[model samples]
Target: MEDRKQALVSRLLQYALIHEVLGIPYNEIVIKRTFEGKPYLECSKVGVEFPNFNFNVSHHGDYVAIASEPLCLVGVDVVCCTEPEKEPVPEFIENFSSYFSSLEWDNIINTGTSDEILVDFYRYWCLKEAFVKAVGSGLAYGVDKVEFHHTNWTNISVKVDGEPLTEWRFWLFKLPERHWVAVARGHPRFATENYKRTICKAEFDAEEYHKGLNLPNVAFVTRIIEQLIPVSHGEERPTMQDICSDCLHLSSREA
Candidate 1:
């Protein structure tokens, strides 16, 4: 499972960095790991600094997710919405509730239904993971230190180290099915509403190397590649409606 997870994440990263971000083929990009084991692109190969390019990858259950931003730090996470087959929902929530803050626990209980509770659990879990990954500490930072308050699904407030943080924002939405995705990014470059989420379901033929890999049916990856390059609007300035017209068209298809 670990090997398969790494391979899938690498494939997604390659596609995202080479085709999406760099506008180059996969062969031209060189990837290196940081001292902390985080993967980053070797910008010198492209003859550009690429100081603003940042990305993060995560996989849980059957899903793998990747997020990238041209000029801001970005982190993303995806998780299955159902509990493990070995444990029931009540028992699973009881076991994991201690890891969440008091308000998070209350939010779960207020969900009222078992299915709703399960979804909420994964929602909070993904958000916490995304935030930690955005900070570049990964799990070593301990998710318990941060708390999330969601006034609504899209509107959220984060408190880390017992203080409110205004420079960060989060987005929570469902993919196609059976999964939830969350994103965390820095301020000024992108707003919460500007972030677009989509479900990309693509199959990679790994039968030659790995016979059985548990790949998810739905993958939640960002569409930030389109934002990296500037679009030319002949003479006249493009309206915000003209920019996000495609997004608005796809909004109806989102789950």
Candidate 2:
């Protein structure tokens, strides 16, 4: 279990290769907590000297994801559709409903399909989580300070601190095995950004995962890898590692 955390940290560092390109060293990466309880990294070695980069991470059962950007705050979360301990939905809704426009809740409650309803509900939850994370206050901001306008299944607009968020965007994608991921970013534009999203299966030879947290025997890690890796939907398959070796060989010739 401890090794799993190490592996995740290693993988996250690998995914943040952009920082290395910024000339930041691993030892120079400074992760600190804000007064609002959000965690941020100081990439001074990479030239982002002014505390401009922020990130958030979350895991469901086994899967985990992180988001980061230059000169902008970013928050990311992934939630497995597996129902959590049921509580009063209205209680939560009432607590933060004021932040939501009347039409928002109306549309939320009137979602035509169950899957759509569930997706929207989680979207709202993740968006709020990401917003609070972006604000560096976690739940201290009282979910009321942030609101989301779900224009459709894919598009969403956010309002924070009573200001319309035009410099931000949220992306929601469905992962295989009923998992969903969301990212909230304060960048001016994402469509033109150099973004790399990859979901690869890091094979474990001796079941390095699922040993801790006393989870069920049901296949959770496999499901998580499926959710993170970008592959044909509904196609459960494995690739030979020799394919990577072959690519490395071919690349050396070009170099």
Candidate 3:
């Protein structure tokens, strides 16, 4: 019940954000999920037209994050760095070791003290989550196949099956509250094509996404629950589809 409640809250926040960004009325904002359960707006059904505008929502600990862009697909994740309560860090991380590449696991374990290791582990986890979310993959996505390559945790790029994905971009930011946030942005068609069995036949303007690379480094401004509440609900709720019509119906294949 608690998990459902939080999910509802996050869903409402997503609706509220779209209202604020695109100037759509709260009652007119329509949201639906992909077969993989990634939320998106069906612009045509919603009476709006924009080229490949996409957004994603995530919440963890005390923060909820949303990343949206018209040029590229975007995913955001927030992870709170907290010590394990039931087991040591190594043990806890071991349970998830299968999700990481051998190289990534080596980097995590070799990193400095226990606290630093915990942070590093969460960083990798956060990045993985962000990438999957960006690509609209659900729980079945093979996180192990997509590996993030970084030098000293900087200059983030991703590789799938040992080949580099040059068009995708990643960024990680540390908050003052021992929390880490990661963002993943990639060309919409490229993002979809890379997903096994998924196809994007629509002509794309890759140049637009690249030209916008001059986009300023965005900083998260805190929005308390109260400030968000007003937009979270509206007098009349619009009908929404359970699954997005615009999303491809491709089934996920194992890596």
Candidate 4:
């Protein structure tokens, strides 16, 4: 499982760079761990300059999720939603009550159906996990410290230490039929108007990964790059040509 998770992260990192999301080469990218055990990318290990990028990875059951943003903190988590038939719903909630906030506990107990309770349990679990991972504090920053309130499936508000936090944007969606995934990104003014989601499944094979690199979806890559680049005051936004030229120059220098 660990090996598979690492492979998934590596592939996503390569995709981010190859598509000009970070303007760095695959070989130059080095994975480093923070004091809290979160993985991040650096290029200094290979004498290349580090680019502005933040990414997080999580895996469960048979799925792995990766999230990246050019200049903002990003975290992603995937949880297997397959419920075991043997465990009673109440017993399951009781076993995991320590991880839930008081409000979450109330919701789970008040939910009308066992299935609803299970769904709510995983939804809150993924949101909290994604938030902590975004802060790069991992579980050391207690999950109980943060609580999520949803006005709708897509609209959410958060509270940390019981104070409302308005700087984060969250996305929650199901991955095919087997897993639930959540992504969190933080900015003082976060908006979901530009947010997009893509889902794909690939096996962790080095040879296949290398082959896949030669076939990036240009339109999709360009769209993501445009969304990730930050706008500056009184300056024109970058064109796709400008971004591609910069990446080409970097690649030539590396060559």
| TM-scores, each model vs. reference | 0.66, 0.57, 0.81, 0.65
- Write model 1 residue lDDT over 1-255, tens digit each, in one string: 253434444444444455555665434445554433444565543323333455677666555567765444567887778656898787888887766888888988788788888888888988987876665656666677688998756677788767887666678867756788888875322222112111111122345112211122233535433442333434333443333333322211111
Q: Which candidate is the best by lDDT?
A: 3
Q: All candidates' lDDT scores?
A: 0.58, 0.48, 0.69, 0.57
- Residue 104 in candidate 1 has what lDDT? 85
- Tens digit per residue, CA lDDT, model 3, 1-255: 134444544665676677777777666666665556676775543232445667777766656677876656678888889899999988988999989999999999999888888999999988988888887874457889878889877899998878998877899988867888898887666454433123222245566557544466587777755665543343664443321222233222110
Candidate 4 lDDT by residue in tens digits, 1-255: 454333433344334543355544433444555555555554433121222255676667655556665434567777777686788887977887887789978976887788777877888888888887776666657778788888655787788889986556778877666678887766412212112111122122454333332332122111232343434445454443433332322210010
Off by over 4 Å in 2: 1-23, 48-51, 84-101, 113-115, 160-163, 187-255
Alpha carbon lDDT at 169, candidate 2? 67
* C-alpha RMSD by candidate, in order: 15.9, 16.4, 5.6, 15.2
Per-residue lDDT, model 4, residue 158, is 81
Model 3 superposed RMSD (Cα): 5.6
What is candidate 4's CA lDDT for residue 154? 74
Error of 3 at 55 (Å): 1.0
What TM-score number comes out for model 2?
A: 0.57
Cα shift from native, residue 77, model 3 (Å):
1.1
